[model samples]
Target: MALLSLRGLVKRFGDTVALDHLDLDVAPGEFLTLLGGSGSGKSTLLRVVAGFETAESGAVLLEGRDIAAVPPHARPLNMMFQSYALFPHLSVAGNVAYGLKRDDVPRAERDRRVAEALALVRLQGFERRLPYRLSGGQKQRVALARALVKRPRLLLLDEPLGALDANLRERTGFELRALQRETGAAFIMVTHDQNEALALADRVAVLEAGRLVQAGPPRAVYERPATRFVAGFLGGANVLEGQPDGAGGFDCPGLAATLRAEAPVDRGTAACALRPERITLRPSPLAGANASQGVVEEVAFRGDDSLLLVRAAGGALLRVGHAEEDGAPPPRGSTVHLAWEAAAVVPLRG
Candidate 1:
């Protein structure tokens, strides 16, 4: 059974609907990421689950029991904020033990639990250090320790690693996932970073303007977005308009060749969305599912890979990725061949 469930949750702020009848279910020991853009209601949904915000309608249930009227303090959950939210005056031990102390846990148990939490976050020796006494990464772990010290059934992380540097954030993303699994707690994190959501989530739920647009495994959501917004928002996609050619292929007017839409296409004859990485580039033309020649319009080196924007013969701009080890691709204005398999084309409607 799912550990947490949101049924038709609705929240409004004056004229703005912060959450519009959002429904979702989070499985036990699962790390679910709530992904969205600014003001997309990702945080608002997390707040509702944390008992920090009450929805105007619907119910919030934990273990099949409604928790709508439960106060944040009384709920079996803890939220780790983006800013860490550690007390400057208190030591790491104090901050982590704050919840236990509030609940009047016995002195021995509080000490043991605090120590265990610190160890879990690899901050065992830094218990005496203040929040300002540590680096950004360490501070984040302290905040995580504090949230986990109480062993809450559910853990809410509000952009928990948003403040870390890019390299650190990447490293901590894996670490956070591991810790969540180790603790066997259902973790629901809200973030705007697509990489973070993909790397850390067991499942991802995307929101837009206070509505649940899509929810599924990270790869499923990325490879097969349900809508144009989801396809373009989760990652970079080349959306194209086309119609079925009657031969199990699509004739996209703006592209140089016919393409095939992946099965289960909502509207096989409508628009199609394909990820940039799915398109393959070749120096010479190749006969395949969808093949065309285009000039390299732009080349951007992005650390591990390079993004090549090719203007196809039909005038549509196609984006393709080349590995860093492939060396520099053909310079700008040079013609290149692009091809993608039938499985790469994700059909969409509207």
Candidate 2:
């Protein structure tokens, strides 16, 4: 059974609807990422679950029980903010003990639990350090320790590593995943970074214009985007317009080949999506599902890889990635062949 569920959740700020009848579910022990741009309602959704924000209409259920009227202090959830939100004057141990002290937990148990939480975050030896005395990653772990010390059933992380440097953020992403696995807590995180969502989440919920565009396992959402917005937002994609040409093939003015679509079509137009990396570029013309002719317009060397911008025969700009120049890459204004399997191209509707 799912550990948490949201039904028709609606939230509005004056004329702006932050969440439009949003429905979501989090499985037990799964790490779910709510991914969206600013004002896309991800943080609002997380705040609603944390009891920091209330929905204008709808219900929030934890373990099949409604908690609509529950106050922030009484809700069985804890939120870790992006800013760390640690007390400047308090020691790490004090920050972790604040919640326990508020609940008036017994002295011995509170001390024991605080120590255990600190140990879990690998800050056991630095319990006496203040927030300003530690690095960004250490400060983040302290914030996490403070939240986990509460022993909440649902853990809400509001851009948990957003404040860290790129290097630290990458390292902490792995650490956070390991921590979630060790704790077996249902972690719901909010973030706009696509790579972070893909790397850390068990499932990703993508939101756009206050509504969920796609929600699935990271690879499923990446490889099989349900809409143009999702396809373009999750990563880069080459979109092309074409019509079915019978027998698992699609044909248009400039494209002629077989493409994998769910059903047969009749005189209707459809769009196809292909990731940049899915495309294979060849210096010479190729045959079958792996071929298309285009003139390379831009070539950029990005250290480990090269990005090629090609103007396809159909007048669409296609991006392709090449790791380590294999012989001579097509230069600017030079024609090249691009190829890939029919299944690699995802057809998008509307």
Candidate 3:
């Protein structure tokens, strides 16, 4: 059974619809990340699930019980906001114990739970520190401890690490995953960062315009997107517009090449998503299918890899990501051949 389920949820704000009959499920002890851009309803869905916003229709079920009418404080869940939302006047232990105190738990039990929560987040010695004295990562852990102190069945995180620096964010992501595993609590996180979503989630749910475009394991969704939008959104894929050539091939005007498809496609206006990392660059053209010659229009050298924009014969600039281990990429304006296996060509639904 699902720990939480949203069935045909609909929410709107006068002239605009924030959630459009969306449905999703969260398994117990699972970490699911909601991935989308701005105005894509990722945050709105979190708010709805936290009981801060009500849906116009559909059911919010927690372990088979409808909780749509349940008040925020009455619901057995907690939300950690992007800003951490730590109280300025409260110390670390005070903040973590706030929820327990509100529920009128016995003082002894509250203190014990607060200590455990702080220890879980690795903040055992920082109990009396003020929020201002703590670092960004420290503050984040405090907020997480506060949410976990309640031992709720479900926990919602909205951009939990968005405020940290790049290095801290990456480190914290690994810690967050470890903490979730240690506690065995189900988590539903909302993040616009693709790397964060892909790295920390057991499953990823991609949303668009208040609708779920795709939801599956990270590798499955990344390798086989259900739509063009999903392909471009999750990982920066190069979408090529083409038509079925009445054979087991696709004629893409952008590449000026008839590429072989792994599977037969329908006869109509068709499209394929090619990830940059899948293509290999060569000095000379190879005599086989799925090979094209192009000129290097631009080159960007990242620490571990390099990105090259190759202008094909048909005037399209294809982004290619080459690893540093492959040696230095060709200079700009150099002609090169690009090749990939047919399996790398992912077909997209219209």
Candidate 4:
């Protein structure tokens, strides 16, 4: 059995379903991220797990025991919201120690735990500082320390890094993952940022319209998305429709030759999800199993890489990524050849 499991989880607000029979499992000590756009039920799932919102039906199981009936405070879990919710009146250490004091822990023990939590987040000496006195990142650390001080069985993070600037969010993502590893605790985070989910999650659950469209490691979900929604959500994808043959190939028209079935081919109106980065662009025409000839429509400088928007002979626009340099990229209106490995094209169902 998994460490935490939600079976047939369903939540509704009047006629609208916030979660529709959502099923998920988090392994012991795993960092699982529920990723999706707004209104995709990611936050709803986190709220349900944190006991802030109750599901209309289903069960929450921890270590094979049902926790659906347990009160929020009685459960061994802690939630960190996007707002941090640190008390402005209390110092960092005081905020961290509040939970322990409420539970009637000894003064010395409470202080020890608070110090340790602060140290875990590299804010040991900043305990006496007020929330408003700290930087955004520092304040977030204090919130995290407060949550960690309790040593909860599960940590619920709702848009944990959304409040930080881009650079700080990236830095804190690494720290959050490291903290989870060192503490060996289960973390379930909700976020709308696809890159953040891909970077920090051990496994990602992509939710859409209250349903789990796909769930797997970051690579699996990105490279082999199970649904059209999952394919488009992760990043840029060149979606193509083609039929598959028995011997393992799709005789696709206007896209060079047949694409290998890529194992486990689904029949009828199947789609291929190809990432822009996976496709290689060359000046000369190339012949291969998975190659498309197109004319470069635009070349965009994206700092480290160039984004090429090419119009294929089939009239479909293909996005390709290539390294950037001082010299001009493949000139606009130049014929370019695109190729990718047979396995690069992922088969997708509705």
- TM-score of each candidate? 0.94, 0.93, 0.98, 0.93
RMSD, every candidate, angstroms: 1.9, 2.2, 1.1, 2.1
Q: For residues 10-29, write the lDDT of model 3, one tens digit per residue.
A: 99988788899999999999
Residue range 1-350, candidate 4, lDDT tens digits:
69899999999989999999999999989999998878989888888887889999999998898888888877888999899999899999999998899899999899889989998999968878888899989988998998899998789998889889999999999999999999999999998888999999999999999999889999988888888888887897877766776556665664645666457554653777788888887667666567778888999989898999988877778888887653567889988888888778887768
Q: Considering summed lDDT, which 10 consecutive residues are worst modelled in model 4?
A: 260-269
Q: Judge candidate 4 against the unseen true structure and give its global Cα lDDT, from 0 to 1.
A: 0.86
Q: What lDDT does model 1 reach?
A: 0.88
Instruction: Give per-residue CA lDDT, model 2, range 234-308, as digits (tens).
Output: 887876677767655566445444455444433443777788888887657776654778888999987777899
- lDDT of candidate 1 over 1-350, digit per residue (tens): 88999999999999999999989999989999999889999888888988888999999999999999999999988898888888999999999999999999999999999999999989988988888889999999989999999888899999988898899999998999999989999899998899899988999999999999999999999998988889889888988877777767777878867887665433344778878888877768987557888889899988899899988888888878888787777789888888888788987765
TM-score of 1: 0.94
Ranking by TM-score: 3, 1, 4, 2
| Clash pairs, model 3 backbone | none
Give the candidate number with the greatest TM-score.
3
For candidate 2, what is the TM-score? 0.93
lDDT scores for all predictions? 0.88, 0.85, 0.91, 0.86
Error of 1 at 305 (Å): 2.2
Cα displacement (Å) at residue 128, model 4: 2.4
